[model samples]
Target: MSDPTFSVRPLDEDTWPAFAQLVEANNGVWGGCWCMGFHVRLKGRTAAQNRAEKQERVREGRTHASLVLDGDQCLGWCQFGSPAELPEVKSRRLYEKGLTKLPEWRITCFFTGKGLRRRGVADAALGGALTEIAREGGGLVEGYPEETDDRAVSGSFLHTGPMAAFENHGFTRTRPISPHRWVVTRTVSPT
Candidate 1:
């Protein structure tokens, strides 16, 4: 069950500080990713570069995310944006081979704070993303999530999130992109 005290908010200029706090607390997330992997390739950029770019995007309103908060402290986030905003994804070769059309929105990554795993932060963030998408004139939303049915995958590698979580949010598996990763999609109606 989800905690009633958890609340959701959009990642904008107002919430940038909270988002930064969570990422900084996690060692810039995945060794300095700063959750910018889907937005742009890191290549040779440092953690500080990633941080600056991410903050710039936020200020320009170019990024989108649903931040899960616990009393003003952001616990995690679900990153979502238009295909143009988030062009990078895992399993690009396989995903593109089967891709007929692009989804209006793509849910690329999810992050939960330390010691808060399995406590519904990801679910709350997912739910929040869907709600925000709906409010922004919903359309087809896509996600690449891992299937962890029979294996022991580390939480560190499950950045794309688990298949079960997307399933719980009404997303259906459209096709398999890799052995453990599948492309899940759902059409959220506009609110």
Candidate 2:
């Protein structure tokens, strides 16, 4: 088959169906996270709750993301928002301790179809997010990604995305959130 075309768009009201389909296609992404890993603490919660909460935020215009679309079909996404918007980070207590500076925006999670992994889907998603940030008058952008290593927790587990993806976008390792993960950032001011 020919290489699938790649592109991304901001997740808006019109694109909710595509985003919903993408998450539902993955069975709610990460045991039913519904891409709310950083939006809410998902412990002791059902997948239905996660899905509802995520959709609600989207409707309220509180959540943000860049959707990697293969021609109207969303195959991947990069979740981002202000620090206050995505307060429930994975290693919150730990990640916050080292957060000396609060970023204007934070890139919290990423999801790509199973078949799209090992390709550039996530990279495109990240690029799309940065583009959106620039459009919004670029400021400090933060992200959480685990350092590359031979670990059992790889693949879909790297929801925050790989460090290489961030580095490719000029993000630098700022602090260590855990033994494996880190808080990275890059400034994007207007031209």
The numbered model that scores best in lDDT is: 1
Residue 17 displacement in candidate 2 (angstroms): 1.2
> Among these predicted structures, which one has the highest TM-score?
1
Q: Itemize residue pairs with steric clashes in candidate 2.
A: none
lDDT of 2 by residue, 70-117 (tens): 888888889999989988777779877877788999999989876767
lDDT of candidate 1 over 1-91, digit per residue (tens): 5689999999999999999999999999999999899999889989999999999999999999999998999999999999999999888
All candidates: TM-score: 0.98, 0.91
Candidate 2, RMSD to the unseen true structure: 2.4
* Regions of model 2 farther than 4 Å from truth: 1-4, 150-153
Clashing residue pairs in candidate 1 (N, C-alpha, C atoms within 3 angstroms): none
Off by over 4 Å in 1: none
Worst 10 residues of 2 by lDDT: 1-10
Q: Rate the local accuracy (lDDT) of all candidates.
A: 0.94, 0.85
